[model samples]
Target: MNLTAESVAEALVVNVDEERIDAAVAIQFKDRMRDLTAGAGGRIILDLGRVIFVDSSGLGAIVSVMKFLAPAHRLELAGLTPNVGRVFHLTRMDSVFPIHADVAAALHGAGHDL
Candidate 1:
């Protein structure tokens, strides 16, 4: 549940500083994400570059976060590892989210002048 948030351009970049998001950390992750994103504006870019694994609970938590953000804010994902990306693809969650190859790409895709 090591997540850090910072404002970059027009997006709020949240970096997942953990190798895995599993059952044990799912609740913590969700709670921390809520805390981090409270009152935030614009797109939320979740940077998962360091995350190598994400279990069902982790995915659920992520989806829950998106739901929480609602039409007010968008939750995008960036830097998914091969294994983690497969889980999203196999589950078809990739279509549900805006996935980018990296944080910079995400920003660029969002029309940032970076």
Candidate 2:
């Protein structure tokens, strides 16, 4: 799980730098999310452009990360490939999180600092 966290406007953009977010990396993903999200305020945009596949475990990990944010913050997903998009749709997670076509779109006008 190669995760990079950067501040973009009102969001903390965390890009998943690997090709897959399956069972093998699910734990790593969750743990890294915890470390990266420390004291992070406002919106979180998870850039999944490089991620091509996600198993059930991966989905659960993502959902858990969202839950950890809770009412004070929000988690948005961006740069979903076709297969990843389909999985989100099939799992009805598309309704749960705001999905953007790409990182640029996700950060558009979301102005903030730190």
Candidate 3:
């Protein structure tokens, strides 16, 4: 899981460089997210612009990342590909995490209008 994390305005934007997050990489993903977000403050925007697919484990991994940052900060999701977005919808995780249409919207504090 190659991720690029940057601080933009009031949020720390983490861009996932993979197209798929499956069982094989779920744990690694979670661990990496924790490291990337360590000590980072304010809102978190997980830019999933390149993510085309996500499995159950992948979903859980995302939730884990959120929990890891719980109370102190928030995790918001951005740039969901169609198929990847469906996984969140079907599993009802979209309501749990904030979803944005693009990275800009996430950075600008947009809603889940996508």
Best by TM-score: 3
Ranking by TM-score: 3, 1, 2
Per-candidate RMSD, Å: 2.8, 4.1, 0.9
lDDT for 24 (candidate 3)? 89
How many clashing residue pairs appear in each of the predictions shown? Answer: 0, 0, 0
What range of 10 consecutive residues in model 3 has the weakest lDDT sum? 105-114
In model 3, pairs of residues that clash are none
Cα error of candidate 1 at position 91, Å: 0.7
lDDT of 2 by residue, 5-114 (tens): 99987789998999999899899999999999889987899999899999889999999999998877788888889998888889998888888888898777442211
lDDT of 3 by residue, 1-114 (tens): 799899989889998999899998999899899999999988889999999989999999999989989989778898899999999999999999878898897776577867
Better of 1 and 2 by TM-score: 1
Which ranges of candidate 3 are over 4 A from the true structure? Answer: none
**Quick one: RMSD of model 2?**
4.1
Clashing pairs in 2: none
Give the higher-lDDT candidate: 1 or 2.
Answer: 1
List runs of model 1 lying over 4 Å from the truth. 111-114
lDDT of 1: 0.90
lDDT of 1 by residue, 79-100 (tens): 9999999999889998888888
What local lDDT does model 2 show for residue 80? 86
How close to the true structure is residue 33 of candidate 2, measured as C-alpha lDDT?
97
